[model samples]
Target: MTGRRRWSTDEILDTAAELLRTSDAESFSVRKLAAALGTDSSSLYRHFRNKTELLRAVADRILLAAMDGYRPQGDWKQRIAALALRLREAFGEQIELAVVWGRYGSGGTGSRLVMEELLQALRASGLPDDEVPVRYHRIVILLASLITSEAGINTVAPKEYEQGMEQFRVAVLGADPERFPALAHFARDIRPLGADRPAAFEDILAAHLAQIEAQLP
Candidate 1:
């Protein structure tokens, strides 16, 4: 009976990764994955204890892919930026996974390695051991929160995301000139929201790194 199983765990994970490309996290299920493999759900259970475990593995797979083939380079700040962006790009490649990243958090060895790398980068920045915890927490939160939130803008549902963006654009365009001076004044310039995200992310990340640099010994 056990000899009937032909799929390897890696194969399952690979197929699951592909499944993530087309399906949002909300709709992803072990049963769906099994269906994709043309097998019963029990086949997956033979390899993964439960959905949560499989999801955790999937998250680690993403983190591992981000870390693989990456080498630390440049100044400490630049190194941090490169690493963060690498992680972001990995999620960006699979927009649906990025959409659900917030829910699972999905701690793994790869995630730990990323944090360790951050701590090392902080050390390179000349930050003192005493300040490591607070500073590390700030960097982690800044990178994770901003990256995932940006991904979630497209959300789990296409119609919902579109509807939300339309309402947001309407508000931005409709705000009273007197009460919302800055937004009103810049509304026209902000017309290209989609095009500005990369620049916005860069500017924000630059400011954050500068703040950390000021604290260095």
Candidate 2:
């Protein structure tokens, strides 16, 4: 390479995110990212103290990018739903990145803003002050768990796993109705794991909202 461009911190984070999206976490490293940027790994250390810092920075950048145009409007539940949908859409693009965000936490300005916004939205739900923290943690945990699970499923090997699941469903459907009536009856609705991720996510969110509503004093 002739003249290596002097990358800014933002540039480094952006490039790092790109690298992460293209590669698995196990193979991701400072050297690989530096090479991708046409610079030495040492250059990144100036912007990030270590790999953990770098990963967190990249994750935050991705989150900010995802929520760039998001605005919390409508009632509390609607606002929460909108924010959740935005997050899901963002994580859905590079589900693997969610693990990184979860590992170190979204310790960036974007995350702070999101946290504040979420708190505000949750408060609008009419929950007592004492219950806010617990409900907040629950919603955040649900989001992370669902995102990670969906990401893991998306990374499943080849396409045979899905085919195998379908085969199993067919087999179950063929079972004797007397012995396995429930399974036989639901066979047609049986979907492969993670197949209904969007619906499942929504259901979880709805459940959380319902719980909050029920507990409101």
Candidate 3:
């Protein structure tokens, strides 16, 4: 079986994901996939009973990648921020995947396991169980919002979005040399730098974590 062409669940999921990304997940059909893979559509039915099952498989594949290499380090807040960043990076890489991920209730094994670990860490840090729920919710919402934001991704091409942001900023803030001193002073800082992203999000999340920790007991 060393050189066999038999497809495993992992291979099928990966192929399905590639298909989803190339097109939309809702539009991807098992028949089409079967055609592309040179197999009968019935072969797919053996692994996945239906499209819903296949979608779940695809989700697991993405979540496994999202949760890969994630480990708690530093203080509880810092650890949560790390998890948040990893989730963001994973979702940001695939917009459709992100949409699907955000749609699921926070009860899947991957999400639950991560939540349990985070709650344990937070509890050990002297945070109450009730507070842990709220804190985790806030962190997830912040990360999801940040990752899905059009503004954040639009800021990707610095020279392009930065100039656009600058023009908009000036018009909205009414760039008065004397009145809006701080805005005038930090104009360049507001302008995006091609290199300032990805890592910049981490820094922002770090700051948010600190603010959250401050609110906790």
lDDT of 2 by residue, 8-54 (tens): 99888777778777777668899988988889988788888888888
Q: List TM-scores for all candidates, in order.
A: 0.83, 0.86, 0.66
Which pairs, if any, clash in model 2? none
- As for lDDT, the candidate ahead, 1 or 2, is 2
lDDT of 3 at 23: 68
Query: Model 1 TM-score?
Result: 0.83
- State in Å the error of residue 74, model 3: 1.0
**lDDT of each candidate versus the true structure:** 0.79, 0.82, 0.68
The candidate, 1 or 3, that scores higher on TM-score is 1
Clashing pairs in 1: none
- How large an RMSD does model 2 have? 2.7
Please, what are the lDDT tens digits per residue for candidate 3 over residues 72-189? 7888777776777677667666666665555543345676666776676677667777787887777667666666563345424558767776767665456776888887777656
Backbone clashes in model 2: 0
The segments of candidate 2 whose C-alpha lies over 4 angstroms from its true place after superposition are 1-4, 163-167, 170-185
Candidates 2 and 3 compared: the better one by TM-score is: 2
